[model samples]
Target chain A: MSAQTVADKVDRTDRLGIQQPRLPRLAPLGIAAGAAVLAVLIGVLGGLGSRIQWGLIAAILFVVGLYVISTVVEGGRQAKDRLATSLVWVAFLLAVVPLASLIWETVSKGIKVTDGYFLTHSMSGVVNVAPGGGVYHALMGTIEQVLIATVIATPIGLLTAVYLVEYGRGALAKAVTFFVDVMTGIPSIVAGLFVLSLWIMILDFGYSGFAGALALAILMMPVVVRSTEEMLKLVPNELREASYALGVPKWKTILKVVLPTSIGGITTGVMLAVARITGETAPVLLLVFGSPAINNNPFDGGQASLPLYIYQQWGAGTSASFDRAWAAALVLIVFVMILNLLARGIARWKAPKTGH
Target chain B: MAKRIDISGLTAYYGDFKAIEDISMAVEPRSVTAFIGPSGCGKSTFLRTINRMHEVIPGARVEGKVMLDDENLYGTGVDPVSVRRVVGMVFQRPNPFPTMSVYENVAAGLKLNGRYKKSELDDVVEKSLRGANLWNEVKDRLNRPGSGLSGGQQQRLCIARAIAVEPQVLLMDEPCSALDPISTLAIEDLIGDLKTRFTIVIVTHNMQQAARVSDRTAFFNLSAVGEPGRLIELDDTDKIFSNPSVQATEDYVSGRFG
Candidate 1:
């Protein structure tokens, strides 16, 4: 019956919602090749210096072409949908391009100096002009400083979040929330300056990795609190009520019901905050007081960190130093990538089971 | 053990706005009393006050004397948590703690009381699930998530969680409203069996459900729009259905008007 109606309405197809045949799988490829050819031709005619301009022009042309083709093949409504989908793909590619290029650049330049020997040994005695050095000491300093910052920041941020989500009611909560927002927007350099003034200037303390860690802690706390508060808010109040109805105390309910429910999100939030702070070079540069030699004591002497090492190597302006800097950049990227992967893995493992 | 409740001059408020006006009633031990009313008639509000769950909302307050077998629930120094422990509640939606396994959702309350061995918890979880008439279906998958079950089964899991700690009173706020007819019947049957063990107070919009499950029914109605809801009448379910004392009760029961 539907087929009969469809056949009868073929002339007046726009009156009803009629299904149209889809584009072939190779259609997009053909459109993309056409776009590329057009872009290259225009680039040649216009004498454009940057090859990047060609890629950008091609992307735009592809999106516009897709909508026009879809409109001619299907209808206005389907064309609009295709336009939306094409626009979304364009947006995704826009986001991915910078990251892809950055990773590609790092890998290409970093492989020159990066090896097993470079990883295990330190730059204790190697001169800036030479090639035999490792990031082991800097890696150690970065780990210790980040770990210390995490240790100091996690509890304060978590407690503040619990207060905001569970028990927040009046002026104090609003004040705390306002301050956290303000803190999040503060420059990392300002935080470093804050630690510099408070710990070094007034207290007469010398520069150390601890000072750098303190600054990073200041940078990390607000992020942790904000992210944690968001995660906590995502926990439905019904769960809290369910726990309360079961005679669970408020604190116990928070610990058992609320926290466990949002544990996956909370872990992801914390890792994101950690990732945000890991590559921060400003505070590390300001407070860490870079040293080439291995420093085991973070509290007493100057130390090395990944970002600081990268900065020093890059600033040295030598072929060898540039190689070292690129290698460190590669290591930092891989470190952050691993942290991201772990966060997602943990989130999946702890995600609440919802359905059969 | 079940306890008789005597409430006198009860009033509930959300900030400055009164929700339920001066209400009074008595509930017998080990019997089902259903509160039937139109929307915003304070049936849910009044039910929440019985266990101090009403105060969970910000600016929500109650003025009343709720005597639970001679103990004043709203009296000075009375802990709301302890009151809630004695008077457990099931909500309108089936909230079976999506984060927990079927076995864990049942054992949650018992664990809150803090002294049960794993073996004791196992026994109580099994019994509670059986009491809710969900044991046969979920017994094999007790380790699975509670949310993995069907909606009706999740509600039963919630029921099991509520009853596991053995509260004297069980308050169900439109427990079957979110369920289908078959699921509603299943819950009604479970409520029937549960009344033998504990005193049950339920708020329901469905007149037939009230008539079927409740021994006594209370009708609540608002005097006018924006006015506090008042208790119109209370009597045996049959009498309330056949011939009510109040005009509004008769009209509401007969579907003349809400």
Candidate 2:
């Protein structure tokens, strides 16, 4: 108690005065007032005559002022980091704002046109100058064609990936890998042309949805194979060893353990591939010739997908058709967005429950 | 019940490079045999060879005989998968299958073999987890992920997983090297209990642990450049610690050259 009393008596109260300099509290207010005065000056000088140019200049000045003020107070490093983060957010908003705005505009404007008759009836009997025709034929054709493409691409892509990752040995797998890399870079138009030449010259087959699907599959396979292969590789080798140690057959191990572990990623990748080929207009235009009415058969006639429907309508150059085209484009975008969301949801839902 | 594992002139190679050559030792029934050496001395490699797990590596191969009872493990047309079924391995780090629940991890091997009825699976999972001394702590959270368990418990879950397949021989490669002192003690206690039913072969860098848990110890070394690992000595644990037959073994045990 005596030592504590003596220590308390000797304690230096003046030594603990603030060491770091206090920040200027009036700085932000001063900067804001300066910005407001400059904006008013620019508005008065320009009035309503050159408002857009003046607004642009004012925006630039506002940004520069903010940068100067922040850096002056916060020091260079933190201010730069903050600026970088702000710029990233700005870029993200720039991309998202337009997309959101376009979607909102489309949904509001086209809801009236997006009815059952719009889905069921084609533009076969309706005149192009009028606004009665719907995208029913295009929607049906798109579904049947995309479904056929998925069926064709999914198995071959999955198997190729399995062989590359699991059983790939020596130079053969290397060769396959190299070729797949090359194929991945092939242009969409090139793919369409290749398919057109192959069917017309080699196979002598006429234009049909099946041929279009085959073309899309050519584009789709490399994507699925590459994504699925990477996903499969992510399944740890320890898991395979664990299965082997259990006396489980290799195939069963792949089916039960390996596939289940990677199924989430595989499904997501597959969905992405589906989304990619679903909007492919060049391949369908080249491979499948157009038919006016509903073509339920994929192997028989040229079926118009949503993209082709929009394309054909826009080419027709009538205001009514142009409206239909914009509306159809909106619908297609919504469909793709829904498919992406569905894929992501399914992946998360079915993902093997690994604990914390 | 424990079982004997005999190796006669066993040699292992990776491609053309011999990793371990002409090494022979026997793991006695119901006893622990420790393999101790410095890094890259092929102690773990030799342990892997005994269970035919060496072949899991792309180019690794073995010659000569590793016999369990009267069957030669290296005989022609022998499937390594069947060999692995009878001889389970625990790795240096705990890998309790991050995607599997605690109960599922214990029953992983059993479920892989066949579709078990729920009652049978529940019993087997419980019994194996109990055998590994992890049942009590995890019983309430059996549905939780195996990875959610503490490091020591995760290692124990891995042990439970290995035993769930009813393996006759258990090979542990520095199993407790990644654990803390208390966890190491827990594993050591579990090892002592496990030896009653399975032939135990362990590879360790820790001499104190070798002395503590092993009945017999084999010391390995690789001195000259470009030479395969050679066994320095193999003897009863008591003699190996107190009075070793080889100078290298004495030096290693007494904290000399590794």
Candidate 3:
């Protein structure tokens, strides 16, 4: 065939063969709106009381409607692709909804009572039925207890992780690995009870934040070890070999090369462990024996922590106490959020400068 | 600082598998000796054995003698760390410590040995980078991360890192295999310059590279698949390429078969 005729035939086939019918760009949004409206109508007609039930119905309808419409317009194969995409989105929203709602509820309700006055004043003289209490004593106790726990756990966890990754070889390594796994699954309350038996029952130590810190340390150690181990394993074997070939001893290589390379990840892990143990109330309740007055010395006497304070305030069953509980809960959330942000900042700061 | 290497009846094993068996050879001081072989022939394994790097692998061991000058590397009471200090190595792909700066990568070995004055470290780093022919390019950006460099520059940086400790012998395992032709040529030139100061043994698959950079060439082969690799021939590079005594060496250099 002539080249011109052949070119024309190719153009006709390209136009006919490649393109397929697709849903409009705004179709998903349109479907979601329709599903929400229909879900509300059904909820009203069926006399469903909760808006949460309406939301769940709308989500299910959105997914089902998208699949049916896409299958009709874009074929079964494209419909399946859209189905997978919508499922992932639904799963993401499912996870995000409760977290967003919790933050929203806390901020809206707690804003009334959480202010500079609430942060700076202690609840020493305030009665549970009346208002005018703050989280000052509890915040101080939480900070000191968590700090002591971090101090106790970090070095032990780091050393254990180093031993596991660098030198762990035979049955001993296997045993240690098994114990770390077991320790990771230990309940926070069990850790509290164990400390209660040892520190309070056996050692005859009085209720103190230090006792609570020991329990928090137990809960935090395995988490730190697990995370640090994963980060250490991520350091390339080639880097170790490189250090070894430099005449550096095994310990020096680990200290200078392996640890430095994974330090960012390790710090982030430790901070996450701290965040996890910060809000643990069972250990604090059993060991520290929540106090109304501020206690500066964690080693000496009873202290109040944020979680324990929240628990006590809610149990009082008064409107003013409920407000204080919500405010304390918000303060706890903000504390955890701050820790997470610090973790991210340290991770970025200490990350290996691999790129410009 | 160059030292002659005398290896006799050397055998290396990984777990229960014999990787290389009964290899014996002598590499002269201040010379470039190239190891050329097909894949899985244990050329790299044999090179690692010279510096006691083979035993770093779990359950991997070596049985034989590798003497540098008068000291036997596998002898009793000889620390592997000190042996590694005397013998430096560059890997196939560039492995500059990702967390270290270019200057720190070169100064890493020096720092491990003992405390060095900052001036001394600067001098050694600059000298080593110059020796690797990387000084002119990286001198201005010595504080930049070694990993930020291009592949060729990173390989050169690794070379500088190896030489900064002033090792008696330098071992390179296919250092140019991961580079483009231009980078390979740059390394070839650097190797030629480096042989004047250190006894260099390099493993490579490229016959042309072997001819271009080496004074002596060792050819390695195995009898069949799953068999332990052995040294087939060691001779002058020109003789190996043109008129090798072994038929297998001739076939390999001429690209007849692996």
Candidate 4:
């Protein structure tokens, strides 16, 4: 449009080439190979105790390599930022690799004995070293116990959170808050021991799934309270005042306004708490007594949960029992994964329709 | 139906610190009274006291009498819940229930009372939204979330929510302070129409908004920083704006000082 040739315009193709020297696309691959070689060499020379030590050294080397490479090519400031970014990525990978490998190992070993027969059949009369046993009783027991625990814990936890956030005042509220925080840090085994002493020793009750659930509920209540309290606190005070100003009573306002506003977060929290207690082995071991046969009634007979099944199978110390153990671990992982997926789904579905 | 509010010897405190002290005034039924003042003057706190909402805050207590027609709001046997049922409040920020639909927001207060049929609920929801002048714009999309509306429309929805319960007095605290000029004008017009059916008291930082909407004006002031705020004067909006009695009122009205 200006009626001038392209060469007549001021151009900086050469200057642009020399201005900034970016790291090559293949630089990361090179860094990975270098770190790996360096890790193995140092690990062997120092006689590291575990292979995990090699990974730690490699992670450190990658970060340092990124920082030094960036400093030489880019600048000091950019090198620091790149160093931080690489460190974070290394941290992310550090967390993910263990989790991924765990799942990978479970899947690979689990598929050998994991099938529809494995899902539906039980280990009622099978020998410990035999390979024909299944986890049907354990699955049923896990579902029932978790359901009972959720039912018992949700309302009590929710009401306590409501009190803490909505009407909490004075030293009493402070004491409750402090106790809840302390309860959160109590070990799962301690909760199991408490229920065992109170119910079996004091009341003279026999082992049952109901007794196990009581202990699971104890472990779960503090989690539910802490999470629900946070969620309820997130509801804006204006919504409550709006309902209050409209002449709605306090209880009605809480039911209609405060709870609904934060219901999505509350449900997610509850489900997470459910998932947490679903895999609890210590409580089930001390209370459930780990039955191999199928028992439908949770309040009467001994129960077999997935966590307890895995522990029993692993303790047998045989190759056949090892397969069952890995398969049971796989099933437990899948159970927790499904609960997490369902929780997220409910959260997205029931979340307040606020966005455009 | 609107009712007159007479407040006397009203003093409020947050723990040991006095927020407002010795404020006395009477608001006539079916009229708009505006409280005009600077920041930290306790105009918002005074409005909260009328509905017993100030006590909702921790350590917030009041020494006063708020008489609505024949009943003492702060009497020993009176329930704060019942008092709130008779006196509704709209806050400064537009806060429609984020989880509720536009129709559900209007129906929320009525549903709490729990005796209305579905048809009756529809009628009240339509009537209240109509009363708030938001019926036509939202009638087609009643099931949409209340928060999806524009700022002015959400405020009107909150107004609709307040009026759905058929309260006697409606209190507003700086209702238009967070709005744009056009939205502010819209809220001002809605306030004017709302005064015909409900006694309204508004707190505003903008003097012009007070002048435009209110029939009477009350000026609140503090003697100095960190001191309890007090009512300087209450008079007709024209007299208060055109010629205030106190020199500090004149200075504040004329933008001389905060």
The numbered model that scores best in DockQ is 1
In candidate 1, position B123 carries an lDDT of 92
Query: Residue-wise lDDT of candidate 4 within B182-247, one digit each (tens)?
Result: 888888999999999999999999999999999999999998888999999999999999999999
Query: After TM-score superposition, what is the CA distance of residue A134 in candidate 1 from its true location, in Å?
Result: 0.7
Ranking by DockQ: 1, 3, 4, 2
Two-chain DockQ for each candidate model? 0.80, 0.58, 0.80, 0.69
Output the number of the lDDT-best candidate: 3
TM-score of chain B of 3: 0.98
Clashing pairs in 3: none
Scanning candidate 4 chain A in windows of ten residues, the lowest lDDT window is: A3-12
Q: Taking the tens digit of each residue's C-alpha lDDT, what string does model 2 give over B47-143?
A: 8887787887888898889988778889888888888888888988887776678988888888877857868888888889999999999999998
Please report the candidate that would top TM-score against the real structure. 3
Minimal lDDT window, size 10, model 1 chain B: B110-119
Q: What TM-score would you give candidate 3 relative to the actual structure? A: 0.97
- Residue ranges of candidate 2 with Cα displaced over 4 Å: A1-71, A101-112, A200-204, B115-120, B224-227
Write one digit per residue (lDDT tens) for candidate 1, span A1-356.
68988777784665565557678878877998999899999999999978899989999899999889988997798889988987888899889999899999999999888888777777899987677798888888888898899899989999999999999999999999999999999999999999999999999899999999999999999999999999999888888898899888999999988988888988898888888888888988888898898897999888999999999998888999999999999988888889889999999888899755
User: What is the docking quality class of candidate 2?
Assistant: medium
Interface RMSD of each: 1.0, 1.8, 0.9, 1.2
TM-score of chain A for the candidates in order shown: 0.93, 0.83, 0.95, 0.90
Score residue B22 of candidate 1 by CA lDDT.
94
Which residue pairs clash in candidate 1?
none
Q: Write the residue-wise lDDT of candidate 4 on A1-356 in tens digits.
A: 46464544434355445456678878866887899899999999999978899998998998899889889988898788888888888889989999889889999998788889889978999987887889899999999999999999999999999999998988999999999999999899999999999999999998999999999998899899999999999999888888888777888889988998888899899999999999899999999998989998999979999999999999998999999999988889999999999989988888999748
